[model samples]
Target chain A: MKRIALLGMPNTGKSTFFNRLTGASARIGNWPGITVDLLSARILLGADMVEVVDLPGFYDLHGFSEDEQVVRQFLQNNPIDLLCLIINATQIDQQLPLALQLRRLGLPTVAILNMADEAEQMGIRFDAAVLTAGLDSPVCFVSAKYGHGFSEARETLRQVLERNPPTNAAIQHTEFAADEALLAEAEKLVARSVSMPRVLEHGLTERIDRIVLHPILGIPLFFLALFFLFQAVYTLGGPLQDGMTWLLTTVHDQVLAHLQPILPGWLYGLLVEGVYDGLGTVASFVPIIVLFFLGMALIEDSGYLSRIAFLMDALMAKLGLDGRGFVMLMMGFGCNVPALLGTRVMRSRSLRLLTMLIIPFSLCSARLQVFVFLTTALFSSTQAPVVLFALYVVSFLTAFGTALLFKNRLPSREPLLIELPPYRLPTFKQVILRGWHEVHHFLSRASRFIIMGVVAIWLLTHLPPGVAVGGPQSLAGIFGSWLEPLLRPIGIDQQMAVVLLFGFVAKEIVLGAMAVIYGLEGDALSHLMAQRMDWVQAFSFMLFILIYTPCLSTVATLRSESKSLVFTGVSIVWSLGLAWVISFAFYQSARLLGY
Target chain B: MSMVRLSELAIGQQGIIGDMDAEGQFRQRLQSLGFRIGKEVRLIRQALFGGPLQVRVGSVNVMLRRCDAASIQIWAER
Candidate 1:
């Protein structure tokens, strides 16, 4: 099938336009490289089903940035039928040069002046006919956010495809002299075709940036934003999570009651106790995950996230990371899978690798759930938040400290540089769509691993005919007892060891696994946990869960992102070593203090 | 008539880029970002602790490290 690549500078509404045309929820963020990977969908235009690929946004085709390289490589490998070059209309002077360069490639190309609404609002006017005449291509004005002038864009695409222009040889010869000449010509063309507002308006974006990016207030406001973000995730998503858990439990119980007599006891137990409960435990976190993504989308779409990179640059630089890497680490709090993918935003491989090494230390929501459950159960309501906050701080410190130790060992590359797009109010639809997409991605990617893990645990606990469930006679029981001595130093028992094993699948399952191991359900499980473990042991357990090896999905992502067995192995070993040492220290010291 | 490094410009100060002293990919990257010679730019802000400098080149705002900024010669507007 013929392909049309949607190419643009970073944060130019290219992904938004791609989503509008293809009806695919390609992630649209106000920051750069949100669409790190090329997202292609079969889009129907005037009865022709052409593949539309959304390439990662870049400033110039000749640039050496990773995203730019991805775009360049893709163009070389895949023959595109039409090049849909999207430009921010307000920044046409800066954007036009790339468009002019792309035009020389001699592909049947169309230039889209995206965000025309914003341009108009800012009193920046562009005469499309003038630009079209100068470029020898159709230039259409479009607001992808509001679905304005899309028919013109679509009609242009259809016409371009019908013309079927041949790819020119100019694309093959990319000399710096030619690029400079093209840029010079582009500068003249932009000056002639576009008119700027006489009085440059100091608009809302600047007003907000005054406070948000203030020398003193920026950092504190950033933390406040984070505090509220976590607060929203826990507060708003709490009841929904409970509702989902309650609903899933009901379904499992009903299914078990119905199937108990029909299926063999082991088979029935595996289906309900193993698969349903295991998957259900992970599933229960969907609400919070959705909320977290929603919050991130809002921040990202409003363009505050880039400012975060701006504010944290100095601190991040100290750890041999860019502010963008810090943004990715913060993203890890929601889920490490996407955060691992987020590392693609970093231009250098070494930087990406180092950032990946540190991300697993962030307290992901799954781990957060376990901490929330334990802390709430074991401590007073007032102390619960403090304990959870302390865990988050520890997670940050661990990630930063890890980065510091490895920064020098890793090969150094480019320094931190980023674009801060003007802040705008995120649309309600976009936020909801992003949230839905995240939840969908999570379920599809993580469910199989979770279910398989739970089933494996079920087998270990249920195997050997006539063996007691989860008792010393079963496989898990034997394994846990054998491993118990190693864990005993950290105040962990056989039950906790087995639950930790199951937790390797996903952190949220530790709670459900705990309920199963202790042969209790719901509130009784919490009560039992409180009665059995002292605050010190509970705190140690939380610390271990906070720093231990990432869940199976995260490890899989690490393997894929790093594309090295050694790196993945190192990640696991490092995390395990840290968790052991830290938890041991905490437990031992607490005892020494005679608390 | 003095040409000052871009890093020397105060926040909100405007200038016309005179010469870029960087080479190869770094130079190309900056040029691609609308920092070509004669392009008008304004220093938007500087991050704390000698972090990146946020500069407005034409309509686009970009953050550049102080080291990179120091290499770009500009004629500051009075």
Candidate 2:
């Protein structure tokens, strides 16, 4: 298919425009030099099916940044049919030189001034004819966020595609002596075509930034902002997850339970417990991931995400991650699944991988369920919260430990250079669409491993068909028994080892597995749990749960997001090793102290 | 023009960028990011413990480490 590459500077709403044009049809493709996947979608534009690929946004065509290299490499390597150059209307004076350079390339090009709505509000106006005439290409205004002038931009792109301008080596050879004059030409063009007030005052943004980026209050305010956001998630994710669970259970009891007689026993078990349960586990995460992405998109689109980077860069830099990596880590506290998915905000491959490696160390809410139970069982009323708080401190320390370990190894080439765009109110459409896209993204990309991993665990517990589920004779129980010798030193007895197997599938089921192991529920389960393992043993086990590898869905997400089996394996191995060492030290030390 | 490193400018101070000493990609990056020779530049704020400086050139604000900022030679207006 003929290809159109969308090129622009960062924060120009280019990706938003790409999403507007393509909807959810976008597919990710890995290129050789670039670290992140470039999204391309095939769409029919004026009866011609063309692939639109969104290139990494950068400052200059002549620059040597990684993003610039990707843009230059793509042009040199591929036979692009058209170039759709997006420019922010508000920043046209600074952005136009890149446009002038590309226009000089004589490729089939169309320029669109995106964020026209914001520009108009800021008293930035344009003479359409002058801009079009000066650029010697079709220049259209669009607010990609609000769908304003979208069809017009699309039609202009179609018209440019129809003209069939030279798709030549002009882009590959932009090294003319007169290349420096492009800026002058751009200035001349802007002078004729654009008009704006002499002193621009974004009063609201300034006022908001005064607090949001304050020297003393900034960091605390960020946490406060996040606290409120997750408060929304806590309020919303619970009921939505419960509703989802109710719907899935109703399907199981009403739909699958009836099929038990018609289907073979093996088939019935596979469908009812394996596939159905696998899907249920994956579906349960949808509400939280969607809610997270909504709040994340709001924070990002409103430009506060960069502020976070700005505020946290100094501290995060000490750990070898920048401000953006800190954002992903903070998100990991809610759930490692979406947080792993959230690493897309970082452009550098090393930075993304390093951030991802540490994110799993973040003790998420799933592990929280196990901790809450363990703390309540062992520690008294005052002690539970303290123990929980201690676990959180350890979580952060481990995250830092891993980051400090890997920062030098990966060697992040992308420094903390970031553009702090003026904050704007996030539009409802953008937030909703982002949330939907993330959920869809999770379902499509990570759900496969989630289902497969869950099914595999189901097999481990259900196999040797004659044995009862999770019985001593089953695969999971057998494996746990086999590992008991290795685990005993860490205070995780055989039964606890078996429960860890279940916890590996998901920490949510850790408590349930304990109940199943003792054949008890509610207070009875806690009672039996306490009788079997004292505080030291329980503490050791909870440590293992806290520091071990991420759950099945998270593992799937790590695999899909990193796109490297080796790195995912390394992450799993690193966390497992850390969990073992920590648990062992605590258990052995407690014994040494004669606890 | 009497020029000094951009990092030498105090917080809230203004300057006209004179020349940048960095070569190859870094120089080009700084220029293209609107730190050209005559652009009016202002140091908005510095992060704590000698962190990145929030430097505004034209209407765009970019955060960069002080080490990188030191390469940009600018005429101080403070």
Local accuracy by lDDT, each model: 0.79, 0.77
Which portions of model 2 show Cα errors greater than 4 Å? A1-201, A242-270, A273-286, A331-357, A362-392, A405-415, A444-447, A493-542, A551-572, A586-595
Q: Look at candidate 1 and tell me the lDDT of residue A312.
A: 90
In model 2, the clashing pairs are none
Residue B45 deviation, candidate 2, in Å? 1.2
True contacts kept of 1: 0.58
Runs in model 1 deviating more than 4 A are: A1-202, A248-264, A411-413
TM accuracy, model 1: 0.69
lDDT tens digits, residues A1-595, model 2?
A: 5789899987677867887998757665766545445677999999989899888678888775556766776776667888899999999999989898888777778999999999999999899898888888889899998999999988988887887853543245646324435645867999999753232246766677678778888889987887688678757886786687678767767887889899998777666666666556446556766776688777767777788888988898888788777777766765788778888867778889999999998877667657766787677877776787788788989999999988888877564567887776656776788778766665564455445555566677778788887678988789989999989999887767877876787776665455444544444556777788899998889889999986877888889888999998999999999999999999999999999
Interface RMSD to the true structure, each candidate: 10.2, 11.2
Tens digits of per-residue lDDT, candidate 1, A1-595, equal 6778889986677757887887732322122223223456787789888878777678878876656666666676566788899999988999889988887776788999999999999999887789998777899999998999999899989988987854432244455346546657877998999653232244777788889889888899999988998898889988998899788778767766788889987787777666766666667767877888798777777777888888898898899988888888878877888889988867688888999999999888778768877897899988998999999899999999999999998866685557777666666777898888877776765665566666677777777777888889999889899989999999998878998887887886686677556545555667999999999999998899999887988999999989999999999999999999999999999899998
Best by TM-score: 1
